[model samples]
Target: MRLKLAFLMSAVLAAGCGWSGADATTESGGGTIEYWLWDSGQQPGYQKCADSFAKQNPGLNVHISQYGWDVYWSKLTAGFIADTAPDVFTDHLAKFAQFVDLGVLRPLDELAPTADINDGDYQEGLAELWKGQDGKRYGSPKDWDTIAMFYNPGALRAAGFSPDDLSDLSWNPRDGGTFEKMIAHLTVDKNGVRGDEPGFDKNNVSQYGLGSDGAGGGGWGQTQWSAFAGSAGWQVTDRNPWGTRFNLDQPAFQDTLTWYFGLARKGYMPSFAEIGGNNPVGPDKQIQSGLAAIALDGSWKISTFQNLTDTSGQKLKVGIAPTPIGPSGKRASMFNGLADSVTSLSKQPDNAAKWVKFMSGEECQNIIGESGIVFPARPSGTEKAIAFNKDKRQLDVTPFTDQVKDKTTFLFPVTTNAADITALLQPRMDAVYIGESPVSSLTTVNDQLNDLFKVAQ
Candidate 1:
């Protein structure tokens, strides 16, 4: 399933120097292993872990570098083509299959045994998720995330609603059920009229009911519409961990997309014009600015949302809510994890493996967990993360953790042509988001996606 590296220098150069930060270059006559990560929020914690690793293994320095998500992937791909990929870098499940297929990832089974890295230490199915289609492990589980509703308590209170009102929201593809009603109730117009009211103006709405990181277009909508789709009994593919056939054309999926986009048309959500514009504001910023009352985001963003402050310098009190139940009578989320992988191009394979091992091990995971950044992949670390959020951050992460414990989660789609599929679907999805196309328009796009899957095979 491997494809040759199609290195486009123009694209790589267009990515620019945004990936450059914190001098992690190896010094002459010294052993310095370069590591890269996307989450700047976890940088200080991982830096602490690296310092600890250096102290324990004298003369070996772990230099960490970070970049924004999009830039990180572009540079990492460019590095792979140039044979200058990092010794170790954090990897995502969505991207790992493609990396493994391209032979860029180093197998980790032998190294894990030597490093005493127990696969059992990771959460259920996490270790297996790092395995390639050939049944070889390519990464070590680092941390996991699930989606939940992040709400601004101030906005909810201003609407004369309690936080408890968000607990049992439900949805249906037909009318959107209680979920749509709740969103309408929470939305407000410029004239201080709620969206559910008769005279409410959709044209001059002052606040939206919900928001998320991305607008509902492109390949996947894990944070945007996937929860609703999953709860409505829609699956991205027939199977995962190597699903060859995409199920984008299914009725349930089309129905879910229809309802999701209908919210924007109803002025319950922001339009693509608002979200994808130049100088577009993010969902977190929307909630912080009182423009959005709720946001469906991942657990990794908890710290960011909890620390949001208004223009008056007052901390915004955020509450967590589980995703609404759909017609299938259950809530759902994408159970995804991040892992650290060694690059096959590395000259120091053993060193890279050691670093990956240490990074995914209890020592480093504990530090990451206690920082309240993300729930670490290991069970013990997850416990620490829960406790840290509850006792220190005073935020209940149960809305996220409960999905894992209750088995109400689905795996992120794993396909070798994820990037290609995304490129093909994004414009079409954007069309749907802007009300220029109907949900049924995706049937044609789905055919194109399935054709790509065939080519991938």
Candidate 2:
């Protein structure tokens, strides 16, 4: 889920206090190179990698710093504007195209020969996503992710549905199928009336059956509605990576969205307005607060949900399930991954490339896998991640990993004009989610989105 990260600002103020970057000395071969990332949860793991690298290469320091997602991107954009960006930082499939266009990221192939890296060392189709239309590698593969449904076991039992019932849940745009029925049964209002029960008031709803990390998932629903759209067999572009045309207005996609957003009106899901503005309550918090019984979320939040604490700080047990079956007769998830790119602004390009290579290597990636926060791109590291989470953390990440093995995962749309795509679609999609605009309005936006690719040509 490329656009599907949880917007938890719990570390915002602390993370944004200062930016530990842009100070790499213009020395020959040995100097400190700054690295930055958005996820505070993954900082410790990367910090250890930085320490290992620094220890291996004396006099060449790697300063790893983290910031909130909003501030991370803002600071990154501002740094790019000022030509003072970090030497090496985490990169996403959605944003790298823009950086490649701006010529701010140094191509890995152009780096010093001493910093040797191999594409074959990573997972299939991962390192390939970091390549531009110019056919130059801009990033080294780090980790990958997918989407799944996480629910409160207590809530599922209360609704008279066993954990096994979720396995065969079927969905369609027409009547929502058994998935909708389960959502209805799980939803309860102020009077403790289930959504399926008579006299249930949607207005006085206290608990929703479904929740997401965000409202409008931009052009890619990801955690919001992507599981349904993807399972319904909808794709964002005609062809990814370098697509010239888009399928944002396809009937299959339109129908999927229509039913997806309709859940809010039925009080089975929270409306965009009900959730906190700008800083929304993520599915993890929703489960913790008793506002939602089930939530479709990305695999990146595996650690948080698997080890959750209630508002009163008591342990809350949560289980995950694969996305329900759709008209496509299969489950689906957006396959996404992250990488680290050395900035063109770096004075220590060789050292920066070395750092990036090391991070992508088995040693560093294995260290990251052991953190149990994400699945690394390297198969060896990925296996380590699966084992550590299941054995140590007691996390059942099979549903997430199964999507990859079962071939039920689709790539996150990788193309240029990603920011522009989100700008044009967010407000309109938010309107659709809130019932302020018809889903048909996106047909027009979709046309406009296609125009962006046309204009590029």
lDDT of 2 by residue, 217-282 (tens): 563888888889889888888887788777867899989888988888889988887787557888
lDDT of 1 by residue, 1-457 (tens): 1232335655566569476644444321267888999999999999999999999888888888899987999999998886667888999887888888788888887664324566789888778777888978888899999999999888888888888988999999898898888889899999989999999999888899987455445437888999999998888888878887778799999888888888888899988887765345777899988888998988989999988999999888889999999898999998889999988887787877888888888899999999989999999999999999999988899999999998889888777787887788888888888889888989999899889867765
Off by over 4 Å in 1: 1-29, 112-117
* Model 2: CA > 4 A from native: 1-30, 113-116
What TM-score, computed on C-alpha atoms, does each candidate reach? Answer: 0.92, 0.92
Q: Residue 83 in candidate 1 has what lDDT?
A: 64
* Cα displacement (Å) at residue 406, model 1: 0.8
* RMSD over all Cα atoms, model 1: 7.8
Per-prediction tally of clashes? 0, 0
